[model samples]
Target: MALDARHWVAPAWGPPEQWRLVETIVPDPGPGEVTIRVRAAGMNPADRKHVAAPRPGVSLPVPIGYEVSGEIVAIGPDTRIGSGEAEVGVEAIAFRVQGGYATALTLAAEKAFRKPAPLSHAQAANLLLAGTTAAEMLERVHARSGDTLLLHGASGAVGVMVLQLAALRGVRVIGTTSEAGSERVRRFGGIPVAYGAGLAERVRALDLPVRAALDAVGTDEAVDVSLALVADRSRIVTIAAPGRAAEHGFLSIAGSQPASAALRDGIRGELVRLADEGLLTVPLSRTYPLTDAREATRFLAREHPGGKLALIP
Candidate 1:
């Protein structure tokens, strides 16, 4: 059976203003595929920035989202998800799939996993990208129990995950945030240090020996402070500061990079397990209607929003 769906697409490389919502038919799952009735779609910077301009090997009319949480409405023969055989009516989450900002979609079964009962659809939709990225950052720095990890942008989506994950590993986190965001860091078991002029001095005043640094904010101040506080450049990692990483000899990781992608893919199940156990949680600041995607992206780009954002269909 064919299902009708509405989805957002960027017909040309430009800004969110250029995106359009169009209706299409979602076909039944082919071999190794499953059809999802989307409950919520995860929003991330990459959902917008990746197609903002023409890039090599990318085609136009690109789908706008990469992750979602939904229910399996149909399953193809030979299809299997991480939880075992795919079945209709089971709640599930999928990541790294195209055209997620839709009422429904059909994607490869491997991209879908059973949703953890502890997380709502909105929270599940927003999980893997930030969770996997946070896990990889911790691994890159070899963060372990008894080590102090300096986390920049500590109150944002990835930063909050880092704080929580570091806590699980028994790693002490001194997270950088704005004055308004301090309590969020503290709530997640991080020592909040405000970022700005004299930022390095503020951290120095903490008097704890910094073991490694993780940068979520790609600012010069963040880079300079990490360099000043941490003696081992290899122990410092950045998701936002690739240029700075190249210039300063520090490490950088992105989902587009082969090594980073492999590491994230390998650990998706572990992160889900953590969420299932209630040790990890996604803090949703707000959710927007599916049609309000453009407005939501604009808000995400311009404001902090204090936590993860999602689009409900």
Candidate 2:
């Protein structure tokens, strides 16, 4: 069957202003792939960063978007989920898909998982990347039950996931956030501490031993506090600041980092189970129509919504 779809594309590496929405033919799924009718797509900072400076080897006119939640419309040959047949019309969430900012797209069957019934399409769309990142960082730091860790930017998307997942593992969390976000941090079972001047002193005042630290904010202050509190440099990881890793001797797990891939691929099914069981929750800040993507990017750039932002396709 032939399919046509509308999608946003970046004509070249530049600014978000350069992206244009246009019509194109949607390719059929190849072997081991399935076609999805996208309902919602999650937006991330990387979306704009990639547009501003395209990744190496990616040419112009690249489609934008990384994660989406939708329904299976067609399945390709040799596609099977866990030794079973693929089911059409089943809602699923897929991440790491190329060109997810479309009305429909084809994805490897293994890369998609059934969406939890409790989560809205917008929430499911935003789940995978942040969840996987959290899983990897926790693994990097060797986080375990009875451990206490400091998490910077704890109210943000990835941070929230880390906080909740840590809570599930019985690990205590001391989370840093703005005054406005403190309540949210607390809601996720983190000990909320306000960020900014005297932040290190405030964490010190807690008088609790910090076994490891994860920086999601990439701020100089966050880095300094983590360094001061966590004695082992190897236990300190930053998802936001890869360049600073060399100077500080801490681990960095940015996009495409080898240390992160295994956990990301291995943890998706578990994350789905956790979300389905009510142990993991993704908050939706707002949803914008796909056409308002530019506006959505602008809002994300300027505001700290403390939750996920999504685009309805």
Candidate 3:
């Protein structure tokens, strides 16, 4: 017998009204897998897109969430994660294929990792997706020490992580964000440039040319300014706006690909190590209970000006 919880259902794609809650069965762990009792989940911008788009044969009435933090309560065949080892009381962040928002989920051991020590469940909840995305993009683009990297949406969750990591590597990071988020950019080791109205000129006035660019903001302005400032098109990548990236000669980051698993795992391990060592931090805006999943997903779809939202299950 398995337990059940609120699983979100999206019958159609119009607005948030599509979400429906229904009881769903939790499954047992398989080989190399572990069952986690979800303690928290993180909402991402892509979750809203998936709910509205409802890709055919992909997922539906699907419990939507890619990132979650939880404890391992069950271990399965070929289980290296919880074998003869003590109970995994440490919270962990996970990236999943489906049903991440549920009360319990069974997933591969590598898809999850122990949470960074000292981070609350809510703080660690948002790190898996956003933090790993930043790490991968920076690596491929090679934003290095003494090289100027242009980043869009510097105040966002992923944007801030990129800035901090690049800064720690001694890279020259210039960022574009709203006026309200300028101070945050500075605090995260970026030179804040206003995102609109002469945005390109403002960056140029800083007396530095962009060596590479990464777009987290999914805006035309971000692509245009990156093309204007950076010389190498291959050095430009977009985590958002993949549909238009080809036209602008920017690299589309295909995170859904299988290779991303290795890269994401590499980054996750480093971030966890850094956090455990007390060298890194994650910022959160607000947290909602699992019963309020609709509210969390709705807010994640809208413009989040402060930080990432977490769901405590």
Candidate 4:
């Protein structure tokens, strides 16, 4: 039997406004593949930003999502998932998958992992991108026990993950957030400082020497402040400010970088384990019906979402 699914795609290189929801046939899983009935799709800024313009090796009508949590509806022969053998009816989460903004997807089984039991579908869908990014940032700077680390954009998806992971490593985080987000930062064991004028001075007043800095926010202010406090350029890393990173001789990492990609991929299973043990979580701000992807993305662009967002298919 053939399966038809409705998924969002960028029919052309442009903004989210240009994305179209089209119905397409989902082929049966091939060797080493599985078909997932997507319950929720993780939303990330990269989903919209990456497809806004044509990049090398990309094609038109590109899929719009990178991660999803759902159930395995079908499995291919000899397929093995990240956890083990693929089987029908098992709940799973797939990252780096094609056309995740859909009711169904057939993707390589290796990309699928057993969803953590404690995580709701939304949280499972929202993990990995942020979690792995956070892990890499901390790894890049060698964040460790008793180190007082500076984190820009502390209330964001990646920043929140950094806070939690750092706490587990026994590192103390001084997280910069808006006054409105202070409680959230504190809830995750970060010392929340409002980001604005005199930010460096405020951090100095705290009297903790910032050994390493991680910038999830890409603003000039974030770059400038990170440079000011953290003495070792090698110990400062940014996900957003590559230009600043290059000019200042600091580290900048992205999924596009091969080494960073490999690091993130290696750490995925451990992150899932942390979630399974209730040591990590995704704080969700809202969820939208998959058909409302455009509206949801518009909201995400505002950059004020209190937490992660997801799409229910």
All candidates: TM-score: 0.98, 0.97, 0.92, 0.98
Per-candidate Cα lDDT values, in order, are 0.94, 0.89, 0.78, 0.94
Clashes per model (N, Cα, C within 3 A): 0, 0, 0, 0
Per-residue C-alpha lDDT of model 2 across residues 1-313, encoded as one tens digit per residue: 8589998999978888889999988778888888889999988988888879857888889899999999999888868742246688988889888888889988788888888788999999999989999998999999999999999999999999999999989999999988889899999899999998999899889998999999998989899889999999999999988778789899999658665776788888899999988889899899999999989998999999778999998
Model 1 ranges off by over 4 Å:
none
Clashing pairs in 2: none
| Candidate 3 segments whose C-alpha is farther than 4 A from its true place | 82-88, 259-262
Specify the poorest-scoring 10-residue window by lDDT in model 4.
Answer: 78-87
Predicted candidate 3 versus true structure: per-residue lDDT over 1-313, tens digit per residue: 4556566656667566767667777777777777788888877877777766646577545567787777877767656652133244646667744767667787877677777777887777777788888888898787778999999989999999998789878998888888899999999889998988799999889998789999998888888888888888889988888877878767878567677767876677778777777767788888888778777767777666388887777
Off by over 4 Å in 2: 82-84
Decoy 3 TM-score against native: 0.92
Worst 10-residue lDDT window, candidate 1:
78-87
